[model samples]
Target: MADAEALTPRVFIARHGETEWAKNGRHTGKTDIELTPYGIKQVHTSAKELVGAKKLLDPARLAHVFVSPRIRAQQTFHLLFEGANSVPDESVTVTEDIAEWDYGDYEGLKTAEIHALRKSRGLDAERPWSIWKDGSEGGESPEQIAERLDRLIAQIRDIQRPAMKGEKAADVVVVAHGHILRVFAKRWLNCPVDLPVDMVLPPGGIGILSYKNNNVNEPAIQIGIALPVTD
Candidate 1:
């Protein structure tokens, strides 16, 4: 039997860097946007701290990479893996399943703005609107998002399981937007989709999901950030 440490596969999720809409608290979905100058710098720094030899994500250990179709996400992925000499271009796949949540009518609107609009429409008068619960009009619901993420998760495990038993690396990386990745994290841990998640992944932040005790049945989110060590 493989040791507990050897067979555990990991998923690394990196949220795309800041955009104009993201900076202003707008719901950025479907619409393509480029990373701001600061956003580019942020991801470059994250790449330095998180990827490479002896880093949280060693390039040699990366088995596959799933990137969102959004430009911001695609740009972030390139920046993060720019220096990863071991990861080949062919190993990456652009998947819509990992794309940002479709904000639909809520696109370009802030939370407060959406709430005001909802109030005007006599929707959720007693409580603020929650995308996890109420979903966006003409957009995907919590159930839909959950279903998509679940399917992706299963695919990830299928790729990793066999590799875990061999000498090849089994780590998978995903570059996506905030809400979808947060919801993905929740679903990764088998938590209820509608439950409020206090967890936050700032722009260019990285989160890790791995199995506990090398058992796929016991998945967990490894909390904490990887920061550069300074003397």
Candidate 2:
């Protein structure tokens, strides 16, 4: 049997910096909001952390770097990797698969505002009525988000396998919105998708994941998400 240590690859992911809605705890789904001044700063700080990790991950060895095509996420990568004022080849790819959850009818609304609207209509705005569960207006619930994330995870497996890279596994860094990233960690660990209801992420925060080992039952995975405050 092979030693229990050499096959895993480190996967790093970071949430985009704060948008005006994100700072105020608003439900920012598919809003395509831009980062705030403080948000730009936060992304820079998060990027610095990666620079510090260079000993273990040389820039050339980064293999792949991707971000959600949404402005907030794409901008986060730009700021983190190249200061956001200009684009760089090193951070040019943005994929739609990891974009923020689609809020449908709830786009651009604050939780407080939504709650107020609910109260005006005599609807419960607490607990179960919250968007994560029953969903809001025409939006998808957390369970739906989990399904989307699972699809993306499958894509990751194909992209990272050694054969896909022509003999070497392709390691990557991803920049994406907050909620999606949190849910991803929960799923990667094989924990229940809704389990991340307890996870909270600040702007420019990060999560790291690694495949532990593949075996008969399932793949062993490790997820390490950082909730650092930078700003």
Candidate number achieving the greatest TM-score relative to the actual structure: 1
Model 1, TM vs. native: 0.92
Worst 10 residues of 1 by lDDT: 222-231
lDDT of 2 by residue, 1-231 (tens): 132333345567778887888877778877778999999988887666654333332344455676788888878776666632333375446666678877776677777777777777787845435555556667777777778777877766766665332245455677898767877777766676555357666788766676544331244434443332345
TM-score of each: 0.92, 0.75
* For model 2, the run of ten residues with the poorest summed lDDT: 52-61
- Residue-level error in angstroms, candidate 1, position 187: 0.8
Clashes of 1: 0
> Candidate 1: lDDT over CA atoms?
0.86
Clashes of each: 0, 0
- Model 2 ranges with Cα > 4 A deviation: 1-7, 52-57, 83-93, 119-127, 163-169, 213-231
